[model samples]
Target: MSLSETQPDAAGARRIARPVPLRESVYSAILDMIVSRNLQPGQHLVESELALMLGVSRQPVREALQWLKNDGWVDLRPGLGAYVHTPTVEEADQLLAVRRLLETESARLAAQHATEEGVEHLRELCRQGFAALEAEDVATMVALNAELHATVMRLSRNDVLVELASQVDRRVRWYYTPVARHRGAQSWTEHSALIDAIAAGDGDRAGEVMHAHTEHTRLSYLEQQNLEKSGADAGSPARPITGRRP
Candidate 1:
């Protein structure tokens, strides 16, 4: 199943499941495109075109666009339809900082609770990440990066932490996508150190490694912004959020 139904219902049925709703799947598809940069930032989202592309009708596209707007992923202009939201530096920094805090704690806890199987899993993921990096497969690298972090969070064995991570994980993927290739080899190297710390059951070392790794990603993004600013000379300014509509 695309969606995992791990929790039991009120009646306590085992692994109760349902097919993911079409609206949600469509929303995810559009969001993934945005995260992957397949749909460029600020590019207009035509409902009919999206419907045709995703093999869905216009209604789901319309609903998905609205949902994206509500979630700050897209903007629905009065007459101009929908467009992807271009993230600003301030926004990225804030979210990445939050990610660092949560993930650092997860790493610490994972080190304390690491099992043989979990450590092996982390190593397997690390190998795959290195392979992706070697093959110059940014998309697969990004996905595997997520999977590795998710595995660490799982090893933490904290349901609440996992849930919180899941909430921000999609946005993290969005922010990390640009920096994936930029941090490719170094990122995996950091992952190797983190895995070693976990395997050694050194909570402090694992926490420190994870914290540094995430901070590096954030700093790299800032460097990229600097390069972009220099390239643009007179960079098109980001639109400031306002209290009242123009």
Candidate 2:
């Protein structure tokens, strides 16, 4: 039977429909693996192995890899096959720069538009994030952190800004995941200040606080990368800041 086409049943009497296209299923599985860091940066993505792991055939896996390549999640080497995209410093910088611009505007607008209830929602997310941090539950903390930022963006009441933020949102989470544990207490502390600025309806202050807050995360990631590289160059084991692979 052709992998991308439907096959007849043994009796040749019934048609079975798939819930989703095989290629899309493969694509989602692979992307989830990438986002979860199970497929680490620069890791080889072998189609046969991926197919086997995902319980699909190689044809779907191949198609999914092509899609992933187009989406900047995979790199198809001319001769060496596909690998997860290892983001360059330039790429990271450019993305984060754009993120800062969008989020700064969002924060400023959020301050102008935030209702008391909206501010309280942010506060609740902040509290949950801090609690997760204290418990050393990095996953929950990261999720809560995302929720807090998303709430602020929503409170901005600008659909255009929200849409733009959504575009880079997943990639931002991918970049943020590795360092979430490291940011810990300090991140939530920044959120607290941002919440205060928003609550006070200080657009300028809110923007300034968010700008600084994001820069902190960007710098933290860069610093950690530098340390890892230094360790490698010095012939020492490169210990991750998070102490465990995400």
Candidate 3:
């Protein structure tokens, strides 16, 4: 059944009652699909196919497309359907710069403000991420990594920083997914260090670690992209596809 139909009371009242709105679900689904490379960059999104895949009506998918367009995730055409937006190198650099600034501050604040419980939560998330990686569960690792970051952001207790970090985080995830598998354990090792810095209340160290971590991620993604392009230029059609990092 469709999400709207599943919420009989809300559907009857013509309202959404969940913590996450229907539009947000649609938006997230589309974003995940794109990030996971199920929908390739510059690939067209057929409305009917999306509706069927998402188990919703065309309305929500259309609404999601509009939201994605505003976020620069998709481009809407007059005659054709929506297409995944391919970010330029300059755009990627801009996003990484903003992300590094926001996340470094978040890590610093989290070091100062994180409670014991918050630290424990982050540890659990890190453990889960490691386990996911060991199991080759790339999707789970991606989700757990997001949870770890979200936990740290919440520990900072700064709403403005949280919001800004979330925006940059999403964009980074979009770029990271296609190249995550290449870097593998190195990513998780950095995450562990960030958690350790926060646990020790080392604000400056936390910030520095986070900055390096994000910078490394950005560089790795660019390198992978360049490697792929070179392979294509060399007419190597048998290059292996790498999974994205968590």
The whole-model lDDT of each prediction reads 0.89, 0.87, 0.84
What would the per-residue lDDT of candidate 2 be over residues 1-246, giving only the tens digit for each residue? 563356435435555665998899899999977876678888899999998899988999999999999999999999999999988877887888899899999999999999999999999999898888878887787778778898999999999999999988878877787888888888999999999999999999999999999998888778767787788899997553332334
lDDT of 3 by residue, 66-131 (tens): 999998999999988799997877788888888888889999999999999999989888888888
Inter-residue clash pairs, candidate 1: none
Task: Give the alpha carbon lDDT tens digit for every residue of 74-129 in model 1.
Answer: 98889889999988889989999999999999999999998999999999999999
Clashing pairs in 3: 180-244, 180-245, 181-243, 181-244
Clashes of each: 0, 0, 4
Candidate 1 lands at a TM-score of: 0.86
**Would you list the clashing residue pairs of candidate 2?**
none
> Could you say which candidate leads in lDDT?
1
> Alpha-carbon error at 241 in model 2, in Å?
8.1
- Candidates 1 and 3 compared: the better one by lDDT is 1
Lowest summed lDDT across 10 adjacent residues in model 1 is found at: 237-246
